[model samples]
Target: MANKDWKTFMIPYEQAVEELKVKLRAIRTEYRRKNDYSPIEFITGRVKEISSMLEKANKFEIPHDRLAMELEDIAGIRIMCQFVDDIETVVNILRSRQDMKILYEKDYITNVKPSGYRSYHMIIQYPVNMASGVVNIIAEIQIRTLAMNFWAVTEHSLNYKYKQSIPENIKSKLKEAAESAYQLDQTMLDIKDEIKDAQKLFEVKSAIVSSIMNDILYLMSLNKIQEASRFQSQLNKLIEYGDVSDLNQLHLLVRKEINRFR
Candidate 1:
């Protein structure tokens, strides 16, 4: 009974949120295609106020303004990225846009509010054209890494459920978790170069081995057993070095083993 009544009140504000999300998605898609950014991780939206609904009554009286936003996310969008650095690149793209007016800027990453919260947030006002009419919606953009998002979602759920009055000990634990996530972000960026190099080397070695084996089989098919056998030994010598560009030192050692194998 309460849920049904809440929906009637929440519907107009909810429509505003849904419309904002559609606009954000269109903007993001345009940027990605224009800039050649592919394999995007995630894009999501939320309208806030899970506990209550917004109605004409929810609209404030007096100097607060009646048509003004009261919900946390009068409109909201979350942009998730693979790399921590990607978050800034995303924020910058939006910042440069003329259509989106920045109402507020909060750098939770650098200036964490001591609530163990971390994200880059921008409160923006953009004119959204809806079937009903054109409305100016205040949208909040949260940019963060997937790891940060995971921690935040957990923290938010706990906060809402417990009314944000978590025990002191638990609050300390949440701070530790946030710090850990920060460390993990730094470490991943540091190791990314090495990881990419290793993956490339692994792929190159696999392709070379397959090519060598095919060559050896072709020699055998032509009845050149001696040639095929010698080439097979040479291929074995090459195998140990994998995809190494400088394999001369390893080549010396492998050649000795290759002769023995033959």
Candidate 2:
């Protein structure tokens, strides 16, 4: 296809990536709103560049007319997790979703590549609405822990620098780094519950503090200066030494303080 034609052809894939990123990020927001720990750390997405796509097509002997059929990763979404166990949670979440249907899955975490590349990959068919009509397209979603993603990025950079002919010493170093990353993920999983509790406590404290400050400002806005000051003092005390780890506890305390003002 001509350059203009290729650009036009790529618009759908670009849309797919952008839409998928937003949808995936909403999952994280939902978890935070519920005061729960999310398995997904972050999400990123990209549509394959034309040059890179052409290169892969040639390498894989894909014909020009069959690029869409052969290139499963034309649209890519990456989901990063904090713990190794989180990867499974994310995968299960995707599997349970009805909006996107999974075409297949590759469990490279259980079957690591020889170059120490490890990630769980899912090929899903997503429907994208275009001006012409709704079209079903294949998008690849990759799930990996933070450590695993870090190692993968470093290794990818090295591979590009060496043109995929990395020297033996550098390859060995990459392998060692991958192993260290795996261990780090494992360690995080060991203290997962403790980490989760700490995170929840922090979220609760922040929410309560914010709500109290907002309420004080509202009082001041209504020219209730004395009431605002008194509430501010109470809020300061709570911030200084509040053992609140849940929303209900914070709400009860704040309610009592507000009742005193009344």
Candidate 3:
């Protein structure tokens, strides 16, 4: 028996991820720029694994001079979104692209895998021009929530540890744990707006504090208390009431501080 020449076709993992990222961004940016779509929300591509390679090799024999795609990814670019509604938005984005061929889709969020794993997967075929020639490769794109991904990571580690012979007790415990994780993901989604609001407050406060310190650096020098106090009225309100929505209020506070001091 002769050894198959898949290596010639198999791209280095780094280059494989990089090329796909570029390909995705190129088309997406063009679409948004041409159509004037605001708030670009989705990102793509991630590192691959050896298991992915073996799987592909076994699935399809490579013709001479062509590379094989092995898409074993552990951290696999799972997009952790804020809304249950956005999953379809991401899927539609992928479907609309002319450069990509939608191989298949499984909506595990609506119809979860029997093991409790929830995600949307598509075996997309996209063209990449390699040194050999133009080639199309299959990259499995999975859309999921941050909580879902976290739970999945923990579950995967346990599966590897137990070597698929998970003890009955542990299996039951894990099933409960997965349910808890699912509840957490749902809770997070339910409070997505609140989470975003809190995150914005944190970002805004950090920005203002840094800005105040920087501005006071020249004249105030090491006067920490005065500098902090200088923006006292504004800082007090922003940080104390972290959970805010009105961007206008924040903007006005910043403007007042700059006008008063500078």
Ranking by lDDT: 2, 1, 3
How accurate locally is residue 170 in candidate 2, as Cα lDDT from 0 to 100? 92
lDDT of 1 by residue, 175-219 (tens): 899889888888877886785566556655665566556656765
Which pairs clash in model 2? none
lDDT of 2 by residue, 1-262 (tens): 8999999889989999999999999999999888778999999999999999999999999998998877999999999998888898999999999889999999999999998889999999999999999888899999998889999999889988999899999999899988888888888999999998888888877877777777667667667788678766766776877666543455556566566666
Candidate 3 has its poorest 10 consecutive residues by lDDT at 67-76
Query: How are the candidates ranked when ordered by TM-score, highest leading?
Result: 2, 3, 1
True-structure RMSD, every candidate: 9.4, 2.7, 5.9
Residue 160 in model 1: shift from native, Å?
A: 2.3
The lDDT for every candidate, in the order shown, is 0.68, 0.87, 0.60
TM-score of each: 0.61, 0.88, 0.66
Candidate with best lDDT? 2
lDDT of 3 by residue, 1-262 (tens): 1234333434544455676566556644785456433122455666545455454555566432343333434223445455566677777877888876877887888887656777778776656677777666666678776556666777778877987577888777867776887888777778877876676556566666656445544425444456446555555565666434433455455456555665
2 or 3, greater by TM-score: 2
**Which has the better lDDT: candidate 1, or candidate 3?**
1
Where is model 3 more than 4 Å wrong at Cα? Answer: 1-7, 12-14, 21-47, 55-76, 210-214, 217-262
lDDT of 3 at 14: 44
Better candidate number, 1 or 2, judged by lDDT:
2
